[model samples]
Target chain A: MRRFSWFNATSLTLGFAFLYMPMVILIIYSFNESKLVTVWAGFSTKWYGELLQNEAFLSAAWVTAKVAVASSTIATVLGTMAAYVLVRAGRFRGRTLFSGMIYAPLVMPEVITGLSLLLLFIGIGLDRGVMTIILAHTTFSMCYVSVVVSSRLVSFDRSLEEAALDLGCSPFEAFRLVTLPIIAPAVISGWLLAFTLSLDDLVIASFTSGPSATTLPIKIFSAVRLGVSPEINALSTIMIGIVTVGVITASLISKRASLRLQAEEQAAART
Target chain B: MRRLLLISVPYLWLLALFLVPFFIVLKISLSDTALAIPPYTPTLDLGAGWAGLKGFFAELDLENFWFLTTDDLYWKAYLSSVWIALFSTLLTLIVGYPIAYGMAQAREEWRPTLMMLVILPFWTSFLIRVYSWMGILSQEGVLNQFLMWSGVISDPLMILNTNTAVYIGIVYTYLPFMILPIYAALEKLDISLIEAAEDLGCSRFQAFWLVTVPLSKNGIIAGCFLVFIPALGEFVIPSLLGGSQTLMIGKVLWEEFFNNRDWPVASAVAVILLLILIIPIILFQRNEQKQREAEG
Candidate 1:
């Protein structure tokens, strides 16, 4: 057993404290009764109420949600297909370029991606709107989705897919029935990742979005640039709450699933 | 046919969106600025055939590239961005290594929860994370208030909207990128190797230096690249936290495009930025390739 030294304990504690302190402060300040974000007053939910009432913020939220759903869904399908091809397709022409495109965007700067995509839209005479934002989000987030799905695909048992094929199932049917179900968890996680990425993106969205559409990040960015406000604190708290719940729930579900699988395997061994 | 269909769908999507847009940026960078809607001249006219091609080729020049060279702002921004990225990447590594080592040495069952704690903030809004610092780092904000109360300082520190704040934001945000890869590497390390080193008359520090550090070199390389590459082109942290004096190329590119509305110049900036990035990017890719090969 590795001994846990005081040094390790201190480092871990300080590290986590550093990681979360700003967020904790922001969350606490969200309910400040005073308009000043930094000043303390008696706790109140006025900012939340005002946030709910702000039509612009609400509409921006609506647009963001719409974009997230549309983009992530399409990204998931396309990314899954990309992952399938990368793992299953053997020595096709331009294989190196195919994989290069897959990995390059993961590390590519958002400013570059956004700039290039905007120029493409303008050059092609495409109207910049919610549709353009969706296309841009789909293009980048699909790379993330493919990354997530492909890691799982790499470890997938090929024989199960082969067995389905041998049982008179067509290739498409085999994939739809056997491979899809088995990789559903990865695909779902990929979708979630894509969704969060789209939601969190401000730079790309700022470049691609027209006057017709604005995302929540863009709204928050413009507001925050004028300095911190109590309303933004409230919004941040709400966003943090949603993400905390989502991530915790996801980890819990995956944990429970693995535990159940372990128990089932142990029981089968006894039998 | 089925196999071909599966490959081509994604292959073509990436070609049209990713590859073609990149080429367009390259093309625009070589063109002259215009007052028209798209803001660049010599748009390809296939209708004019070979003559049009000749005209387009004639119009294209390295004028914008020359313009970038003449301006001190462009080169200075590039240099400062590289310097800032290098500095912050070092800072992230310093802060992250101990945390990652601590996690690797932690109790087995606590590892997952610890990992999740690190990732939870990542899943949250990045803008919010950067924005959250404003309330703490401002002149009259929490840090100053606390420091004053603790008698650590007599006056409020001017941190927000400064290069210092940009450093803080970059280190805070990219710390996770550094920690994860290092943690993965440290976790896979054989403790017995360190034990053997200690048993063979090496001191604890020497054992760590000889065994642990060398073993985790690949992780260190991966983590450094992960932090460095993104930090080099980071837009958000600098734009929000950095003052007007802060000169990051990403911010420069953004202002040139949106604020100045100079598409050709902006494209040239981006092209240069991409050129600067290509070296590190290729190194990162090669590192990833080597890691994969080692694992396989």
Candidate 2:
């Protein structure tokens, strides 16, 4: 057996505390009742009520929700199509370039991305608004979606596709009818991924977005410069709750599907 | 064969939107800083330029490109960004490795739960999380309140609006980015290899060093890049946390382009920033290619 020492215990405690202490503090203070952030008065949810009634923040959040939905929806289809092309298009000229192009944003600095898009819109004389923000968000988010979709695309059984074509169905029909169902989940997850990315983004949104096109993040950022209150913590706790529930649900669904895949494989072997 | 064109359409869309935008940035960066509406004067003439193109490319200049190095503030910001990014990445590794190891060692069923825990932050808005740190670390905030409540000090500690806050903010936001890839790497590690090391009379530490650490190096590298690259250009964290004291390249770039409206200088800074990052990016791609080849 490995040796257990006091030093090890201390270090582990420090490590765990370092990882979780801030989050603990944030959650605890979310319930602070007083407007005075320094003092511990009591507990309340008034800040949440305040958040609900704040029309400016609510509308900005609504705009953010709309952008996430529209951009992610567009990105899912485009990204899946891009992945299909990348995976199914075969080795050809510009394939390397095409792949590199998709990944450029992954490593490219956000300042560059934001600047380039800003300059592009200005040069084209296009008005800066939600439309521009949506376009920019989709550009980077689509790369992420494509990468995810194509990984699953690589693991797919090609013979199933080939067999469908042999059974008197056109290539498009075969893909639409056969391949779509198997890969549709990846596409949906890609959309979720895109939605999260769009929601999280601030720099790209800041650059392309006009004064009227404020995202929740941008709004929070501007408000935060004045100093943070418990209201921000309350907002975070709610966000954490939503995201935690979403991720747990996804993990459960994924676990079920993987188990089902294994069981089907085993049953096939028995046959 | 006819199906190939259908496949190509998606890429064409990216080329038109994504690629074209950068191409335009490249174009504007090459042009002279004029007082035109777009504030660009197209030369299309290099005048025996760096690339030595005559008619089609004579409008570009190496003046703005070479002129960037002369600015002391720009270099200072660059150095500051590099320092912050490196330190934050190092801090993340120190904190993340143990959790990754624990998660990797857990039962298969438990591993997914741990992974979901790490990824739960990503599902929420990062902007909110960073802002959450701002609240926690501010002078009159919970951190100070708690410290004072415990009678640990006579007065509140002035922690906010400093370089320390910038580091805290960055690590808070990026810790999961560092953790996930490492956890993914550690999970796929072969248990038998570690067992073999143990059977050969190696201690747990030795087993980790000899068997586990080397195996997960790719994940470590990927995790470092994932944090470092973004942190290098991070704006929101430094801007909010550092206030006026923190000067990073990203903030400088923002001030130059947006605040001062100096488009040419901003693009010049961007060009240099891209040039600096290309080597590391290429190395990252090469490693990714090697990993893919091994897996394939």
- Among these predictions, the greatest TM-score belongs to 1
> Per-residue alpha-carbon lDDT of model 2 for A199-253, expressed as tens digits?
8788899999998789888887777778776677777778777777887787678
List DockQ, one per candidate, in order.
0.81, 0.48
Candidate with maximal lDDT: 1
TM-score of each: 0.98, 0.90
Every model's Cα RMSD, please?
A: 1.4, 3.8
Clash totals in order? 0, 7
Residues A193-214, candidate 1: write the lDDT tens digits: 9999999999999999999999
Q: Give the TM-score of candidate 2.
A: 0.90
Clashing pairs in 2: B43-B59, B44-B57, B44-B58, B44-B59, B45-B58, B45-B59, B46-B58
What interface RMSD does every candidate have? Answer: 1.0, 3.2
* TM-score (chain A only) for the predictions, listed in order: 0.96, 0.90
Worst 10 residues of 2 chain B by lDDT: B43-52
Q: Could you tell me the lDDT of residue A242 within candidate 2?
A: 76
